[model samples]
Target: MQDAVYGVVSNYYQNKVKGNHEVGLIAVVHTFGSDLKWNPHIHALFTEGEIDKNNKWFKKISHIPYKYLRKSWQKLLLDIIKKNFTDIRTKRLINKLYKTHNEGFYVNAERDIINIKQASKYIGRYLARPAIAEYRITN
Candidate 1:
């Protein structure tokens, strides 16, 4: 699952975010949400832009259409799952999900980070946090 997510995201950035270029990024997989549910997701921190084949870094365009990202992500994720699991029931379920959700899966690219220090702090707190913090658990 982790590999699939990373591969899809990298491909999305390379092909969609910046054509003919690759983007550097770090993806942290979070298997559980704050409520301690078995909800898997990824937190990826991408470079402000992309690096072309010429080894030149280019800042990404200001606008990245959320709709495109969502649709692309949904397609890629479903493809990955279908390729890995070939069972009849699984394939049916995936197809049903695809037909059910026209907008695709949820892929949100949060606000940009202007400060490196602040970004680092935020990443550390989010990616390194425990699955279920004792403080967050009520008695």
Candidate 2:
């Protein structure tokens, strides 16, 4: 899952930045959501734009390609699944998913993080949060 998030975001930035230059990011895997169910997902904080090989930022992106990202992320994840498992049923299911989700999987991001402080806080909030708050867990 971590690899999936990193791969999808890296691909997006690499295409945008147009170089082998690195894309900085930190991805945290959460096996549960706010409700504490076994809902697996990733929370990632990364640079909006990347530096080029010549040590120059190509541009400051105010927005990301959401549509492109959704499709790419879906494809990559399905590919990963396919690679990991060689079962016929799994392949059939993956094929069906490709045809079914024409618009691709859902991918969301904040419109803008504004600054490192905000981004740090946002990621930290999720990382440090408890599955069940202490007050709620009290008997």
Candidate 3:
């Protein structure tokens, strides 16, 4: 699935893309849901500019096809898992995966990252903070 995410981004960035320069972004993998449940998802942080053929930075992408990105990621993950697991026991697991795949997957892209000011502040508070915050305390 990791490779799938990377491939989806890389393919779009490398091919079928124009105008913007080739840019690199960071992908973060989170396997838990918002309510602390078991839901696997990925958060992709993409740069606005692309690294051009000449290695220059271009402006960010204005319009992104989020649905296409989601489908591409889904297809990649399923393809890899099917290839790696050919055993019977794993077959059942694969079946379950397929069933869940019907529900579809999610891919979010942040296009308006003009500067790193807000991100830097977030990091400072995130890293300096503890696992549980005061808000989690109950009466």
- Candidate topping lDDT: 2
Off by over 4 Å in 3: 18-22, 52-54, 88-104, 109-111, 121-139
Ranking by lDDT: 2, 1, 3
Model 2 poorest 10 in a row by lDDT: 55-64
| Ranked candidates, highest TM-score first | 2, 1, 3
**Candidate 3 lDDT (Cα, 0 to 1):** 0.65
Clashes per candidate, residues 3 or more apart or on different chains: 0, 0, 7
| Candidate 2 clashes between residue pairs 3 or more apart in a chain or in different chains | none
User: What's the residue-level lDDT of 91 in candidate 2?
Assistant: 94
Over 1-139, each residue of candidate 3 has an lDDT whose tens digit, in order, gives 5567778776776665666455575555666654656767765555645776778776545555877676777778867877998888877876777688764456655555556896665445533444355787797
Q: Which stretches of candidate 2 lie over 4 Å from their true place?
A: 52-60
Residue pairs clashing in model 1 are none
lDDT (10s digit) by residue, model 2, range 61-132:
556688987898898999999999999999999989988998998887767788879887898888777778
Candidate 1 — which residues are off by over 4 angstroms? 1-20, 134-139
Per-residue lDDT of 95-137 in model 1, one digit per residue for the tens? 8988998897888788877898978987888877897777877
- How high is the CA lDDT of each candidate model? 0.76, 0.80, 0.65
Report lDDT (Cα) of residue 45, candidate 3: 58
